[model samples]
Target chain A: MIRDTIRPGTILRVLVLVALIAFLVAPERFAGLLAPLTTNNAPPIYNQGSLVDLTLSHLFTVAISTLAAAVVAVSLAVFVTRPAGREFLALSRAVVNIGQTFPPVAVLALSVPAMGFGEAPTRMALFLYGLLPIFENTLVGLSTLPPAVVEAASAMGMTGRQRLLKVELPLAMPLILEGLRLSAVIGLATATIGSTVAAKGLGEVIIAGLLSNNLAFIVQGGVITGVLAVLISDGFQAVARQAAKKSGTRPQTET
Target chain B: MTMLADAGPDEPAASWRIDRLGVVIALLLVVALALPFATFRATRIASGTGLLLHEALPAPAAAAAAAALVAALAGAVTLRRPALRLAAGVLALVALALGVGAAAAFLTPADNPYARIAPGSGFWVGVFAAAMLVTDAMVRLRLGPAGRLIALAMTAALIAALLASGAWSRLSLLAEYRSRADVFWREANTHVILAAGSLAAAVAVGLPLGILAHRVRRLRDPMINVLNVIQTIPSMALFGILIAPLGWIAANVPGAHALGIRGIGMAPAFLALFLYSLLPMVANTIVGLNGVSRAVVDAARGMGLTGLQRLFQVEMPLALPVILTGIRIVLVQNIGLATVAALIGGGGFGVFLFQGLGQTATDLILLGALPPVALAFAAAVVLDAVIEISGRGKP
Candidate 1:
């Protein structure tokens, strides 16, 4: 199972991590290094707030929305797949399609009128935007179950509920997780837009940079968000592979 | 457990009295009947938003809606025939129109010159319910491609006729559009240009990288991983990231500023969109090429076809449809995403969106938001047609 012991990717990733840590721990040291990118000695650090605060807020917004999206999407998928809820499948599909088609920025704009500003509208927009991927994957996962396995479960006199809970869900968990991973990554990126609506996240740093034409601020925000997204996405892929291994199936490398 | 097994197939029927669809329809009706249809605002963009205003429907509209809702409810409860379902769907659409018309007529009081009205939650619920009904009916009809196309064309024609009749002239969103029609068109053009430019770049870069990744196995994962990482960078952050390096290039390089590759504006916006689009395009190309059946490749080899010949004649033809599908996804995504380019002074309908946000003008925001959604949908449909044609050619 062991592949390359010393991957170029690994080296690049470590270098990035060290650089990021250095940037956060002692940003002033990089001031001289980034001076060329600045306009006539503009401050090299993003002074709006600490990078730590921005990162924490960014992660928090993404986490809340992604978790909410996953729960709702998975539940809706499960509901529609169930025999009693099958009649609503077309309607559910329509709902998700609407959600997917409507851009998140539009959602944010429309929602601001009703929900006001700050975190609430942003959360609502993020939650709606994240629904489609998770719902689609969960539907695929649940529907693609082996008929033989279901029959075998029934042959053991397992209840309908038990078969769904124990067999179908477990088998489908990996795909569902893939959906979650996608939603989270997307949420991670989209959450930055929340700053426009004054929701206080990493986007503030980026926006501030844009307004002031400060390259240092821009890079600082971009690097943090970029690194966080990459790490989270990779982490999710590893977890998905682990789930596939436990499920006793050859991992499908969709990611 | 035995009892559960015995009752499994029967349970669904026993509990199918109304079904989830019926519940949705019922809920929609209940909400429509209870809530306000519109909110009247004193000015275009003010914080002291007034109370939700309920207006009584005209007698004919009220009767029409009641009858339509009744028919829809009856259809939901008892109908199984496709024709009947379609009728119910049409009825729901009528109800929706009547409801909206009633709200539109009452939005600005006859004597009030400075007031604007926005659709309230109940109006949205009714619209969604009608849309769902129509979609469900379409599913029930199981129309072929031609039928669906005709339906779409007919709907478009109807909408065009309505616009021509100036039915929406009084609408706040339309009012907003009318005030700055030239700028609206300009923004729309810019939006299209940005999306198209980025899409072209994405294809140019992605196709080569995808081929290289496919050819060299070791390069596949890391390249794909890098692109995926690029995709996960927020659009704003990605745009921000491009600012510094591009600025440096523009500032330091000779004659680069003249070429317009600056920190802000179209340069950074296009670069960011291109970066975001790479993963889908590249991944699709790889998937398409790899999907070329091994048996067919073997046959090509056995026939003494050269590597390039086999790739062009065998793999390329087979992969074209999937590759196009990838392009469709990327194009649609870019259209939606290009709205953010407005933030960086890249120009687009997002100009209206941000302005609307700043001014607290909902109609102005919608003026920007609606076009990109429409554009994306159009791209999806047209690309789907292309995919269908290519697939048919294969067979």
Candidate 2:
């Protein structure tokens, strides 16, 4: 029965690995077929930078914003859960809700002028855009602990600080990790759009393709970005799974 | 807090005291009363336009002070439950109306017809603070979904009445829209078409895939991963990628080329948006279907019902709410993402948005950005109501 089951995930992984290796070892040999994807009067294939460099920049942009968002969101979540900070919970929630509601494009457009056209504005937009999911997830993680568990911790003479660090946070690790994963995955896609504001990433190739009507550049850019996003998401999902296993808590998938 | 606990029996002071949210209202009011309400600009663009000496017209200081006083009075209301709720709601609404009035009054003083008065930092902050205060009071009132809707409707009606009164005829955003009314309406129609078309396409593709994934255990993981991967591709990159294959097909295939599937335009934009919408729809459908109780399924089968009959009669009704929730997310998401289509010459409000960015015109950007936001928000609210109603109908 087990052998009868064709594991599509394994096959997909192997296929993707082979494709990545082929692309890296011989870019022309692998992605060369895409070169013909051009219309009449289209510009030559984008040669300003290699795929490897663009991938690095794309990952860099997404990573920085995701990290920044995670730090800020997790810290804010922790703060609002504290006794003195509890009153500000609704206010914080409202702020994050507004952040979620504002589209990334609007944020990018609004930010570009003040911050200038580069990774700075892109990072800012990504950070703001990614805050809500992480914050809300962390809030849910921290707040949903069983009352009896908390009472027991208090009864056992644990200090407030110790209880938070040793008990509550560890129990909430899987959920918090899930939030970070969500943020990182979202950041991956949003970072590409940053190219419109002159931020260096895979999006520049795509934008270049659009402007020049060159299918090759678009295909190449899209493939690299799509692959990177998949890999990044898989990596995060694996980490979340490990975290869940360690903490003995099933990770909730629904937002 | 301690004082309330320690109050003398003779003094019913606790019943007549202002709370923390009220204090925020008072503080914001004080800030507004002290600062300038708005700034007046000379032209739309041009850092150093001809003979330009930009004027920073002062606010209608008296009207602002009056608004602040009203806000403070609202915050101080401690008349106990029902009375307190009513008084605070009225006061917050009054404060909001006055804030708008103050802004209007600020614009009226601009004698130059060409002058544009932008809401100043003080006015913006005051309005936000007042809104937060009102939201807090609404929370205190413990309003249900229906009550909240009524409150929102009332606020909208009030704003419309204000607009009818010509209270904001000189507002910068409205003026920008007025100048491009024809183009704006056209773009708005295009945006709606793009959003709705993509949503319909997504539902068509996603619904069956979701069911297939749910039924086949092995297909579920890989299928979901593929959808998730698709979602992660930046919208711009996705649109870019589609242009190549789509453009190629349009060129080579006689049928496709005739159907308006060009390299850049609505085709690629719609395709990209359709891809983006699939994930949530598929995920939600699977979740909804899977959530149906095993016992209910057993009961349905025990009744000698066929697979299709059981699914239609029992499972679908139960899953409808979850499915609708998915549709809601997709609809709202598509609305926002459709704005990106403008980058590829796909007509939408994004024309104004990108143009505004290119020109560094904040008001113009707002003109494009606000409608999509309002659309997404309205879509979400309506969908939530649908989900709620569907949920309530289930046995």
Candidate 3:
């Protein structure tokens, strides 16, 4: 279609593409995405290798943590969406809202006492915050299932669990995926807080730049973080769109 | 009016019930009159506030009179059928007002045993709480969208009032009261003003970009996808990244420093803040635009409106509520994240927020934190009220 080639959001696409291209070639303009491992005494927060590994592991943590949250959120949503479970739905929603409202930095500080200042606590915090979108969307998706299809399945002798797994879950998958996409995006952003609590991530590079007052290092960190955020969020959105197409549903990611 | 018009056109009913409201009003007035008499050291209060308002009277007598006034106002709390939850609210205001008029330190000597609840402090709380409740209620009852716009006007008024009335001089608890008021004001108000500015700048830049992309289908997804990605970057780390580059620009650029560009001040902190608000604004704008009906657009085009005209006349209006919602979200969020900008010395209300955390001075932090939280919530509610008033354009 004519709309496909010159979409309304064209400039945004070009700009983002350029940013991505420039970022991928970053190693060519520089040695790598990180500064050297050094021991200059100041606010020297993290070394170089940790920075590299931190970025990689942080992504993994986000992916896995979000995946875990997705499972819990979706199932909770399904269970709570049942006719007998309306109260649970309201309760879970309130819980999710409070979880998101409880600031991440506050969580980081508090988690230090129990989780001992590292990736574990940061992951826990991200997982907790990610629930808002996923849980909210799952309930929405499950509730929106077409009645005719559900009745037809039930009329054919599908058990309660059978109908949920076969018909309801499939019907709700697209909306559920949208929730996951939002969670994935939020989870990736929040991963930066890990640095303050001694959790490894791209934030280490940022913290490093701050301590040394090095402009290049700061750009390196910001560019990399931006690039990562863009890539992962886009990937999740793509999957969500694909799921929406398969299910033949409206595409919506905004909550 | 349809149910949506909100207020019951019952002003005559409201006025007629003033007699019913009289118990609260009278009680509050009496309490204000009597407080100086009951204050810990009546001798000092007689000289303190009685020197002015009731110069003819003694402190104990004044304090007793004020207490009596307050007890009467307290009766308003006894009313039922909270009626849009305003009855409980009005009673709260009257009690607070009378309490302040009676107990404020302005009317009692510093050493007065009962000076703990100074008349000055009480009056501020009483008046503010009363004003807030009544103002909010009136807005809902009568003004609608106009109410929200006026709320912002009111917040500005409150700020001015705080400054003019020298209320800033009295905004401290007993434990923290002796500290510098100017310092606290600077540390608090500056952050809020800066946060608002940053969010505004973000919306300014983001809206046009979003509109452009929304009109360009090919550009929309990729651009939004990138914005989506950029948004996922942690705010704290993003701040860390801007310091060096922005600091360099500040040091090197001519007159940049003169333009309020400190290494870690408004510019870089704003750059970080701006970037953070981008995704939501851009995405929401695009989504809102996309959500607009194609048939209506075609009709606008058919009705002889040019593309630009349609954008302004049709699309923009329809998309506005959604775009504003996005703006509201970003604005509220940036206010919170702006607190972190203090880490880089960007000098916003966050200065106190972060310090409160670092020093564990909940009092100091509360001084910083409560205002912005209150401001953001009020803004959100007012905006919702505005959307409610905007009426069927699609929020």
Candidate 4:
């Protein structure tokens, strides 16, 4: 089993992970590799703060905002789909659809006016911006469940609450996870822009680089962010796939 | 897909029913009435005191505006006809716009260049509620594409008339626009170029690549995966990543500087946007082409049409709607991303946005932010209509 787990894909993933960790811990160690690209005397490694801490802060912001968004969006989706709350469905859909057209950067910039410069506004922007995909997917997931399965739950004398918690939620879990994944990916990207608002994140490194004309810092920030986005997205996809398999549902193909 | 398709069963016309959505709008309007209508600042960037509606407007005008709000709330509950509801909503919107202008004018001390009056949270909430009212009424009316376009035109005309009348002259947003009118237009042009130019380039390259991926079965997944990876990179990071390599090329390669290739500015911004746009463009093309019925292609082939001829004359037409959908996505996405190009001196609306951010000037930020949003929204609507029209003529 151990040997079977040591496939090429796993090896590649492990190597990438190791490289990311090494880069974060001692970016200066790679300064020689990047020296050819830098013309100025400015340090090649971003030294204002540790890249590891910035990465953690970035992940924390994304996680907190995505969690808040998932909670609120899932509840909103649940409410709108319920018979008693169905009257507000159109309004909710309109809000979600229109909200998405506003870019994350624009939203982040706009939030600074109301919330001032800090992680607070950043989190708020991410939460609001992340609401769409998760809400939309949860709506789709819950509504598209096989009617017979719901009927079978009903026929088995399952109460509405029980049916929702036990039957409906389990079946909807994979798509909900997929939605969360998209929201998280978006939040991670947008959080980089939050540094402009004085929020601590990887964006600080990139902005510092941009201001100082330091190519090394820019590359460090950009490459790490890009890698994090891809890895987190892939991680979520893997989890979603697992959920789908366990639920006996076919995994949804990425659009 | 039809989850929100007017699920409520029809009721008798004589019966009274509470519009639940109307209730929400009415609540929002109430909240709007209670909050500050505008802010009065001694200078453009200074913090200001919030002014309530009654304080911001003359007594009679304030009373009239208050009455209109009450009427709108009542109408929301009692109005049964869609036509009447739409008319009421539009009237309320017009009143709200005029009220905002009036508040700005009243609050600003005449002949004082330093005084600035900006619309506050209440004004925004009122606008939101009024917009929702208008949109809900329109959706209920089930207006056709032409009617919707006409509605958009009328709204635009109303705004143009307001601007021409100088009703919003005292507003700080208008002041920001006036001061940098030339720069605003220039940046606006650059923004359009960044978005449209990148999209055009993406289509030029993505289309053929998409067709190639479709034809070459083994290439599809890898091609899509590569593009997806590109898409995964945040716009800021991607822009940063491109700067060094492009800079090196511009420095080492002769004539690259003359060709306008640089590490920063439009070159990298454009390249980044072009790279970002490829996935949607290419993916949509593949999906659209694959969706074309094999039977239809076979029929075209039986008619002695060559492969290229079949692709153009038959498959392309059938696939056009989906391809257009891709274009819509790319256009909207690029419009938003173009604002980020301002970071690297790409010269778009983001210049105003970032400048506003640095200065903490809300009106400047609004000036920068609002146009791109309006553009993206307008593009989505127009493309959606186009897609629908194209699809309508199909089987």
| Cα-based TM-score, every candidate | 0.90, 0.85, 0.64, 0.96
Which candidate wins on TM-score?
4
Off by over 4 Å in 2: A1-31, A39-44, A49-57, A94-98, A112-117, B1-36, B47-61, B64-66, B69-114, B302-305, B393-395
Model number with the top lDDT? 4
Relative to the true interface, what fraction of contacts does candidate 2 keep?
0.42
- Candidate with better DockQ, 1 vs 3: 1
Q: Order the numbered candidates by DockQ, best leading.
A: 4, 1, 2, 3
Cα lDDT tens digits, model 3, B286-361, are 8889888999999999999998999999998998877877877787677667766766677765565455445544
The native-contact fractions of the candidates, in order shown, are: 0.55, 0.42, 0.26, 0.52
Model 2 Cα shift for residue A110 (angstroms): 3.1
Candidate 1: tens digits of C-alpha lDDT, residues A136-158: 78887888898999899999999
| Residue B122's lDDT in candidate 3 | 32
What value of lDDT does candidate 4 attain over all alpha carbons?
0.86
TM-score order of candidates, best first? Answer: 4, 1, 2, 3
Model 2 interface DockQ: 0.36
Query: Candidate 3: deviation at residue B74, Å?
Result: 24
Query: Tens digits of per-residue lDDT for model 2 on B1-395?
Result: 01001111121235445555456556776675455555556765533111101122233544454654564445444433533545554565455454544454555444666666555555555666666655544544555456656766786687788767766667777778889999999999999999999999888899889888889989988788777878877777788778777877898898997888998899999999998899988998899999999999999999999999998898878989989988988887888888889988898988888788767787787788878877776676556556766788465
Task: Score residue B389 of candidate 2 by CA lDDT.
Answer: 62
Tens digits of per-residue lDDT for model 4 on B86-190?
A: 777777777778998999988878678888999888888888888888766766666666676777788789899999999988889999899999999999999
Flag regions of model 4 displaced more than 4 Å.
A1-7, B1-14
B1-395 in candidate 1: lDDT tens per residue?
00001111122354335455756776786676566655567777754333232353566666666677767867756665556776776677666654555556656678876666666666676666666666666665655445655666776676677567776566667668889999999989999989998899889998888888888999998798778878887788888888877887998899999999898898999989989889988999999889888999999999999999998899878988888888887888888889988988899988998888777787888888888977776666567556766766562
Better of 1 and 3 by TM-score: 1
Write the number of the candidate with greater DockQ, choosing between 1 and 2: 1
lDDT of 1 at B252: 89
TM-score of chain B of each: 0.86, 0.84, 0.64, 0.96
